[model samples]
Target: MKRRDFILTAAAASGALALSPVAATAAPMVFTPGVVAKELAAGKTVFLDFKASWCSTCAAQERVIAALKAANPAYEQNISFVDVDWDDYGRHEFTKSLNIPRRSTLVVLKGDQELGRIVAQTGESEIKALMDTALNAATM
Candidate 1:
């Protein structure tokens, strides 16, 4: 498939070719797994990354995540990183699952309470801050 000129907003996703129930159906983005929920309930911290394949911001964030993961093995071990596919990812259902109307939404949840959410922005520093916050929450 041709790369989209730009990452589409969740509003634009209803018309996304990949999201078509006809041509194809995308898998939902799962930032945190069931285990994460359980761990968080047990006082663990979890970081869920809601992203898409066509989103340029997601691609850039991937680099930052790689570096972060490499820099801190403890972060990798202590925190659970869940990558939820946003684009074409099970339209409507997944959208509702997020309870949000947009893609590129990064949410940090301490158990069930959300610490922070980043939407429609690609600032690495800000994203890093949110991730850091989530990691801290898991331990707290």
Candidate 2:
């Protein structure tokens, strides 16, 4: 193979590897119309991530969330993480009922109460705190 071709292939391989974590990470359930209500009724803490594929803020928050969950397995073990694709459900009543202002919103709900929320915020600490809240509520 040509030197240039070899370099390009190496770079592409590295890029793919870097993205493997996001792919390999346990994915949250895609939100269906009544999934949230069902989970909440079952006494599970729900972590709702309202995101769009094209949103950079959502991507950032996802990275932070993935890292946090990897660091602490309890978050995933205790909470039900659901991905609400903004493109699909952004205008749906479920979102409107929650008053989600926009994509990149992260909400933690337990029972009939909202435990915590973060909107368009991607700081590691902030995301971790929200996860912690969900964990606490889940274990309570």
Candidate 3:
């Protein structure tokens, strides 16, 4: 193959990869209490991610949430993710009020109603299903 042809092929491949699923990443979660309360009051699907920076399961769940949201962009509009940093904000009054048992816990709620809860779950399918429960509940 010609050098110019090789360069063109590589550029095209890189562009395709950029548009692929491998480039998909989860969106950032909300960390503000006032925003969370406002979203809930507005009847949005709320996801409380009780996480610590040092927790592996929390990291995995974060990835799973991102991938799911990437596949279903509607989740961005319908779901409001509130990340509760157990390492920094563990003793915060709102954290205490949520009654999170441990780090890496995911609590899904629609307004005031609890939809589903998962603790230290790393399975992508299971995590997506759990999130789907919240999505399904939100539509109803």
Candidate 4:
């Protein structure tokens, strides 16, 4: 292919990828001590994602969650999504308190009550159901 044609093709592909749904989805808030508690105290429902950067299971779960959120904007609007890096907070008191067993854990919390949880499962339907539970709790 001609250099100019290749360059233009590459630029077009990059722009398309940039505007993809996954790319447009908003990222969850990075976990910070007291942030979860603060959200709970304010009566907002929270969806906690415990993941590690290097874990394949975590990556799969993240993709499912992102897709679910992209499909349903209500999940993002009603639930306070927080991402807790397992490497940073795996042994932290907060994780221990929630009884999170491992990195690919997803938990939904509402006013000190855990509405639902998923561990290492990356099925789209399952993740969507979990997200639905969070949305229900949040709207309640």
Candidate 5:
């Protein structure tokens, strides 16, 4: 194969890899609080949901939270969880702190590292899986 051809092929392969899923979207720091910051510093896992009053999705997400807790009492009990009020008085502070564009975000972090996130999805099972993965990763 010609050297020039090889170089062109390599460049195309690299570009495609960059466009792949894992490389395409790095996790966004949509929500992070002081308490959550502390937990992460201690290598603890935080599973939090950011929501506002007007978003119907937030209300439904709350139900998912309830069901998740009921199903995994042990995990629910151990995980450090909190809700950021993106609706009212706390809105500006949270949005500024996390550089969040909108509400209805779920963030999982261990200190400064984010494992995964669920965006524009309402599957209860999938959300729990992401939460559990973060919780499980923190322990390891």
Candidate 6:
């Protein structure tokens, strides 16, 4: 290939790679209440995202969590994420059990114990702090 053409192709490929979702982020697996129960029973750390599709705060939190996971794969691996779709399942039994007050609640739990929580918070630092609480509990 000509040098100019090769350079242009390489740059395009690099841009595509940089913009790829698989390269930029690692999304946590979605979990149901049953899975949360099982994981908790097995002494796993859990990050429960109580969210609604219409809630912008929830989307912000999701982005923060995704970024955090992408940054710290080792820490993320020791935790499980459960996205409770409050838009559809807001009134479910697990919501009642957790006493989740709204659509933007993020509950951190280690086993049957509550570690930390955030309600309608979008700050990345705050979300990371909340997640750190669960990770700390897991190590204890």
Residues 1-140, candidate 2: write the lDDT tens digits: 99999999999999898777455568899999999999999999999999999999999999899988877778888999999999999999999999999999999999999988999999999999999999989998
lDDT of each: 0.63, 0.93, 0.80, 0.93, 0.68, 0.82
Answer with 1 or 3, whichever has the higher TM-score: 3
lDDT per residue (tens digit) for residues 46-131 in model 4: 99999999999999998888888777778888999999999999999999999999999999999979999999999998888999
TM-score winner among the candidates? 4
Alpha-carbon RMSD of each model? 13.6, 4.2, 2.4, 2.0, 16.2, 3.2
* Candidate 3 least-lDDT 10 residues: 21-30
In model 1, which residue pairs have backbone atoms overlapping below 3 Å? 26-88, 29-84, 29-85, 30-84, 45-138
Q: Give the TM-score of candidate 1.
A: 0.63
Candidate 1 residues lying further than 4 Å off, grouped into runs, are: 1-36, 88-97
Q: Name the runs in model 3 displaced over 4 angstroms.
A: 1-7, 22-26
* Model 6 lDDT per residue over 39-140, tens place: 888988988898888888888988888877777765566778778888677898888888999999999988667888989999999999998887778777
Clashes of each: 5, 0, 1, 0, 1, 0
Best-to-worst ranking by TM-score: 4, 2, 6, 3, 5, 1
Candidate 5, residues 17-67, lDDT tens digits: the string is: 986644533232344446666766777787767777678888787767666
Error of 4 at 124 (Å): 1.1
Ranking 1 against 6 by lDDT, winner? 6
Mind giving the per-residue lDDT tens digits that candidate 1 earns over 42-83? 776666666778878777776666666556555665666667
Q: Tell me the spans in candidate 4 whose CA falls farther than 4 Å from its real position.
A: 1-16
TM-scores, all candidates, are: 0.63, 0.83, 0.80, 0.87, 0.66, 0.81
Candidate 2: where is the Cα deviation over 4 Å? 1-24
Task: State which candidate, 4 or 6, has the greater lDDT.
Answer: 4
Off by over 4 Å in 6: 1-25
Which pairs clash in the backbone of model 3?
A: 26-66
